[model samples]
Target: MPHTNPASPILQLRGAQVAYGQIQAVKGVDLDLFAGELVSLIGANGAGKTTTLNAIAGTLQLSGGSMSYGGDSIAGLPAHKRLRAGIALVPEGRGIFTRLTVEENLRMGAYTRKDKAEIEADMQRVYELLPRVKERLQQVAGTLSGGEQQMVAIGRALLSRPKLLLLDEPSMGLAPLIVEKIFEVIHTVMKQGVTVLLVEQNANLALGYSNRAYVMDGGKITISGSGQELLHDPKVREAYLGEIA
Candidate 1:
């Protein structure tokens, strides 16, 4: 369930914009994410969903507008600084280090933290959540299957102990069962008090898990509603859910 009480948003964006040379990817977008809510940004390919996530993660700089996290302006923060500030991004394509072992990959997420004991406890939690990743701990990450790699990618992000998790296309290029498993992990993460901002291509799945959702078209947000509201919306159904109106 979404948080209903009035509280400051964990993250807020006002008129946020991004560009690639002259090509504007995200245009004047405003978004808010409250603590402990699962929010989804859904759209077709090239609709600027990924760009929005990147901008929030500090991987890409905004050409215009303002962004704040935890009530503090962070438009000028760098990617590593954002990560250290409890914002972790599981970027598109997993972004795992191919040559590293699974354990090494997971360890990389905790690089910013110096707390050894807490890190080990978090690693145990990840193993419990993803037993397959534990089984592949000694194996090279490059040799893992797509599903396993995705697990590793998620587990690595978890090890960061982030307050906000930015997931970009986490369901991409995976089997149905794998996608289900990935969403399960996301649900568990949300239950554990981590706020999630998901950019997903699967509208039905994304909305099913989201507390609220936004629809983006051609670099602009066209609709916003509760997950259930959007799921039943005629326009949303016709445009994104493959349903005839």
Candidate 2:
């Protein structure tokens, strides 16, 4: 991992809260993402991990609290503004335009940017990271397998040239081998200077690859530690890791 400045976080959330009608999904969630670090949010269904990401991406508004990026307040920014500010989100479902070719989908990701040459270069870089995507670049996105679609989603997010990448359930519903490949690509993305905030159901994989992790339940963060520490903690092992502590 690259040296991250602890004093300055790339993304910061203080007492963040999100609600839907009568139910609160994320309550007073305080989180930080430092530059060049892979941070994870691990939790069960309805744990609010996805909600947190949505709030940060500006798709969902925070009922209370504040969010800042690089010391500037982003609380009122819309989703497009946030994307323009270098925050890109690969949502849970691998949202790609099914009818579009892989290349078309990738091109859409760079819509917010004006540098055509840089965008093409970034697309090539993504192809290097995911060769399978390159092989299927001219194919329709819907014709690809689930794993390939996931790659397209990630590749699209990369094309945005984001400072912080929010990945929700990148490994969900994929085979073990495909998941491994995705994780490998994620590490590569981090090494290339994009900070990642991952929300995943696979606690073992998340804890293994992340520098730090947070456990959320009941709409709030309940535990946090270094990845290794959480991997070995009795409570974490029992609850998230499927180990009978």
Candidate 3:
């Protein structure tokens, strides 16, 4: 299991709800993430996992409920403010800048910061973590393979030095081997003191790397527990792990 601080969570959500016009996406969901822990939100397609993540990242405003980060209410904070406060989201579909070189895309992650020396240091660190990105630094981001683009996307997020990293469907549309590599990098991020909330469709893989996980169904959290607990759960097995009960 991943090590987690017993102190108050770095991120907390209570009775959170999000709506688009008359359609509600996330409903009354509560979650907590302690420092240095890797937590996952897993569900079937359209279960509101992505919406919940967006709410946390301040990309999608919550129609109801409250969110607190680092003990301060952030319901009114904008996405850029949230990013400055150490919240970074690597959205699904690998949102890389197609027109930019790989190096330029990575540099964009630090646009909020003026700390030139630290930024360069962080850039070096990212290169160490993702050497493949270094190899294609001058290459156009759009020309990279899916796996490489995903790597660049993650490296870009890490450049922000986030305290809370939100990843949505990182394993989607990648080869199995590449997916494994991505998860390995995520684990490394957690070990370096970043709290991670991952939204994944791969339940087994998510649970395997998670310290804890929540099961979302129809915009509500149906169950939550330690990773090992949910991994062996009969319901989780039957529904997500392709196991017959």
Off by over 4 Å in 1: none
Model 1 lDDT per residue over 1-245, tens place: 55553899989999999999999999999999999999999999999999999999998999999999999999978999999999999999999999999999999999998999999999999999999999999999999998899899999999999999999989999999899999999999999999999999999999999999999999999999899999999999999999999
lDDT of 1 at 105: 100
List candidate 2 stretches off by more than 4 Å.
1-4
Model 3 per-residue lDDT tens digits across residues 1-245: 64557799889999999999999999899999999899999999999999999999999999999999999999979999999999999999989999999999999999998999999999999999999999999999999999999999999999998999999999999999999999999999999989999999999999999999999999999999999999999999999888999
Quote the RMSD, in angstroms, for model 3: 0.9
For residues 1-245, what per-residue lDDT tens digits would candidate 2 score against the true structure?
32446588989999999999889999999998889899999999999999999999999989999999999999979999999999999999899899999999999999988998998899889888999999999999999999999999999999999999999999989999999999999988988889999999999998899988999999999998888888889999999888875
Compared with the true structure, model 2 gives a TM-score of 0.97
lDDT of 2 at 181: 94
Better of 1 and 2 by TM-score: 1
